[model samples]
Target: MAPSSNTRPILLIVDGDPEVLRALAFMAETRGYGVIGCATAAGALADLDGSVSCLVLDQNLPDVPGVRLLKQIRDAGIRTPALLMATSPSAALQIQAAAAAAPIVEKPLLDESLFQQIENLLAGA
Candidate 1:
């Protein structure tokens, strides 16, 4: 669907790493998405609402794990698409996230792959 002022795709990025957050923000904005960057899970949770179309969450955050946060959001009935970014999550953690239906994205992130995932998610939405 064509992005309009009232329907622009909103991507919420929850990561504590400054460089990664900046890169993700630049990539999303360049692709015509409205990017919202938060350094903590608390911040992202606070901002979660209908406006956000997707979430790019870091696996390890100062306050909470990404999988836990995803569960919280799901329990709250917010079914926005989610991508979990991690350097290397445990096998059990990965399984849990998968069961929750959130996709995983590896860290040291590749721009092309990341963009492709974002595009696919947005398009599917």
Candidate 2:
């Protein structure tokens, strides 16, 4: 079931670009999700926990790549579903993310794709 207003899903969004982070957070908020925006892998890691319903991670994070960050999170035992964001991901990155079961949401996010993906992930989760 979709979460009620009082139980809105919390999203952990980690992106290097401040503008993109703000824009993504604004978009998710408009869609009824709470957003915790972070500019680096460390910040994201610090905030990650069971309370975060989902993760929107930029593939090119400055401190650590998004996929590696996901690995660390998994190693820490947080099973939150993650959506990997990339402008143009290489094949190797694609394979790695697939192995980790993270779907890549390409940049220039258009047509509410990010929200759609979030809904799908939430539904499956």
Candidate 3:
């Protein structure tokens, strides 16, 4: 099932790791989504031009924390649905992400859960 070109979901992925970013981009593209991959917060922010349907952010970005970036986006009035990916095994980070109303997908994301989550978000939107 190819994504509809007229209304295909756009996903913005912000992560510094090339490997992870590539994997996520592959997953999204294979699933018929339009993916905008950014390696920095600045890059992601630059691409947030209201067309994006969802954000997939990395918690351990080299420039700033993923949550902080998310906050900045929210402050700027971008209410796109977001999923945070955490590289560390920190329960506190997970709690913080939950408190911010964003779902957390652990690094080295295994199984089909992440894909399912993305599908659900797109379907809901």
Candidate 4:
């Protein structure tokens, strides 16, 4: 689907590391998705709404674990699709994210697949 009003679908990217957040924001924006970078889980959660089409979250945040945040997102009745970024996902982490209806994105996040995954999550293709 094409963006409406020249406004792309919003991607809320949360990561504790400044560099990673900036890089992801740049990439998303370049790909034509509206981007919002959050350094803390609280900030991301605070910004959640129907406008946020997808969430790309780091496994460990300064304030809350990504899985916990994902769970909170689901519990709050926010149906936005979320992708959990983990360096090396364990079975438990995978299970946890799945329980919250989020899929895991293995980290060192350098791949075209990430964008495709986001598109798939948003069903924008």
Clashing pairs in 2: none
How many pairs collide in each candidate, listed in order? 0, 0, 0, 0
Collision count of model 4: 0
What lDDT does candidate 1 reach at residue 17?
A: 85
Instruction: For candidate 1, report its TM-score.
Output: 0.89
Model 3: residue 79 alpha-carbon error in angstroms:
0.7
Q: Considering TM-score, which of the candidate structures 3 and 4 is the better prediction for this target?
A: 4
> Which predicted model would earn the best TM-score?
2
Candidate 1: misplaced stretches above 4 Å? 1-7
Q: After the best TM-score superposition of candidate 4, give how far the Cα of residue 85 lies from its true spot, in angstroms.
A: 0.6
lDDT of 1 by residue, 1-125 (tens): 33676677999999988887898898778778898999898999999888898899998888999989999999998888888988887798889888877778888785576666776777773
How would you order the candidates by TM-score, starting with the best? 2, 4, 1, 3
Question: Between which residue pairs do clashes occur in model 3?
Answer: none
lDDT of 4 by residue, 33-99 (tens): 8988999989998887778889998988999899988888888888788889999999999999888
* Model 2 stretches astray by more than 4 angstroms: 1-3
Greater-lDDT candidate between 3 and 4: 4
- Stretches of candidate 4 above 4 Å error? 1-7
Q: lDDT values of the candidates?
A: 0.84, 0.89, 0.84, 0.86
Report the lDDT of model 3 for residue 102.
80
Worst 10 residues of 1 by lDDT: 110-119
